[model samples]
Target: MSGVFIVSDNILSPIGLTTSKNFGQLKKSVSGIQKHHDTALSDQPFYAALFDQSGFIKDSDHKYTRFEQLLMASISDALQNSSVDAGDKKTVLIISSTKGNISLLETESYNPTIQKRISLPASAKLVAEYFGFINQPVVVSNACISGIMAILTGMRLIQSGQYENAVIAGADVISKFVLSGFQSFQAISPGPCKPFDVNRDGISLGEGAATIILSANPKNAQGIKVMGGAVSNDANHISAPSRTGAELCQAITKTLDNAHLLATDIDFISAHGTATIYNDEMEATAITLANLQTVPVNSLKGYYGHTLGAAGLIESIVSIHSLKENLVIPTLGFNETGTTNPLNICTDLLSGNFTNCLKTASGFGGCNAAVVFSKQ
Candidate 1:
């Protein structure tokens, strides 16, 4: 199969508007999370990484919501830097998001016209049309692994000769609906989240958008290559993950096998560490089962909070930069060992020549996805 290369990418978040700006903040151990007491989101004060909309100018013509603006901003940056033509007949657009334009329903202006935009597919079609994509847009909303799954889907399509290029973008804006849902489960952390730490509590909800351009043509694509990917479900629980971590481990193992790489070959792991007890434990067990217990691992949830659908893609782009820069960014907010199985959590930025990286994400409904990338 022909390798899918990440030719261009961008991250629009509270920390910065571009990939380099985001990475620059990460290298400094700076977090975008802050105490927020917005009654619209939650009655109680909570820490969250939110977009700084102070300078945002709403478009009166299109009436694009904040969520739509984020998606467009990130994809616009990526498309500007990429060689792929958005209007090409062979190019595709894939959108990954758990909830797209759902917040519009909460406004007093909600009506039949607004109701039509609540559907994920409808939002994707709007984005596709905005970008002038010739092919039908694809939407992936399978829990938190949606971003990684979308990237994997694009890779398969390009490798199968179905599309020559794919512009994948994901975004999720924090809303009262999402905030209250996690609050009901007591999954909201009062402060910054501490992933894989003994005193870790829960996740700090965040909102952001990310875009990655995957192309079969490697010309001008001096970036990381998408080697392989796999998705699996444990069918263990509705909201909880598999206790044994076997399901996630299977996905990781299969991804590595498909990439023709060994466990030891992976220099680092970008884990889906939400800082929640069950999630951290399950991920630790999975890494151990995959014989990657010793590999350096880190989670960006501490810095960016959990950005839901955009987490996987945003983190993957950062990992690609980490490989290119030969640096393993620290796992922010980690202090002590917390998991039953030992993990090499980088508490400080470590400089090294990284080659292969493994990015894994697990979400509700027992879904898990893993993707392997290599430095070109």
Candidate 2:
């Protein structure tokens, strides 16, 4: 396979709704989550991560879903920071998300059926055309890991000569539908999420998007390269993470094997630590099984809240940026370590010269993924 380089990275999180603001907050340990007050049915008082940046496109005639708006803004920022063409190029756009227009599901009254909506793909198409991309792939992997899957697919397409370049985009927003869904699962944490913490309760929902540009070759000598990646399914549970963590470990193994690297070569790990007791415990075991203890690890969920389908790409964007800045931001709100397995909630961004890095994520539908990124 050919080398796939990460030409650019951009994250538009609630902590800093734009690229500059997001990076500013990253320098500090600021988080954007707080008790959501806009909805009446959300009685559990869920923490919501809402953006502070103004919607990039502003005009009475400009109309778009909140998801599209966030995605467009991030892609714009990513291109601005990259050597790749965002203005006029035959770029392939890959979009991933879970609850697309569930934000449109309105429970206006005390009665009526909750609507089943799917509008993310069409929205992505519109945003792609607006962003100057001539080609696009709409991926609504309703499965949680769909976000990272989008990034991986984009990297592969570029690496395999299928496309000269590709832009991977992921975005998701909270709504009554998503909130009620999490409430149904009782996965909404009233308190701050503590990934890998023993007393970890559950996830907090949020809205955000991250976009990365991948080229067949390095766009800038400074970009990170997508050396290898792997995906697998546990087939052991519907919503729960397996204690065996075999499938998760398999993905990591295949990824490192393909990259011709060892666990010891990875300087740090961006974990999917969702803060749920089962996920943290499961990931803790998987990391040890993969021999990742010597490498420091951290989770972004505590900082941005869980963006669902958007988590992987968003966090991956931050990872690439971390490689450029030479710092791995600490896991916000992570105070204690709880799992029986060996895991570390990195409390600070250790300064040093780093090169190879790993990112892993596990989600519903028994989906799991691991990716190897290298600074070129």
Root-mean-square deviation of candidate 1: 1.2
lDDT of 2 by residue, 1-376 (tens): 7777777777788776565577668778788787766654476556878765556665356566677788888888887777776543546788888877566656333323323224555777678778777665547574778887887888777776778778888888777888899889988887878777667899987788888788885445356788888999999988999879888999999999988999889988999988888988888888888988768898988888888878988777777777777888898867777888767668887777888889999998788998988887
**Residue-pair clashes per candidate, as listed?**
0, 1
Query: Ten-residue segment with the worst summed lDDT in candidate 2?
Result: 108-117
**lDDT by residue for model 1 over 241-309, one digit each (tens)?**
899999999999999999999998999999999999999999999999999999999999999999999
TM-score of each: 0.98, 0.92
Assess each prediction's global lDDT (C-alpha) against the native. 0.92, 0.78
With candidate 2 superimposed using the best TM-score fit, by how many Å does residue 187's alpha carbon deviate from the native?
0.9
**What global local distance difference test value does model 1 have?**
0.92
Error of 2 at 301 (Å): 1.2
| Deviation in Å, model 1, residue 200 alpha carbon | 0.6
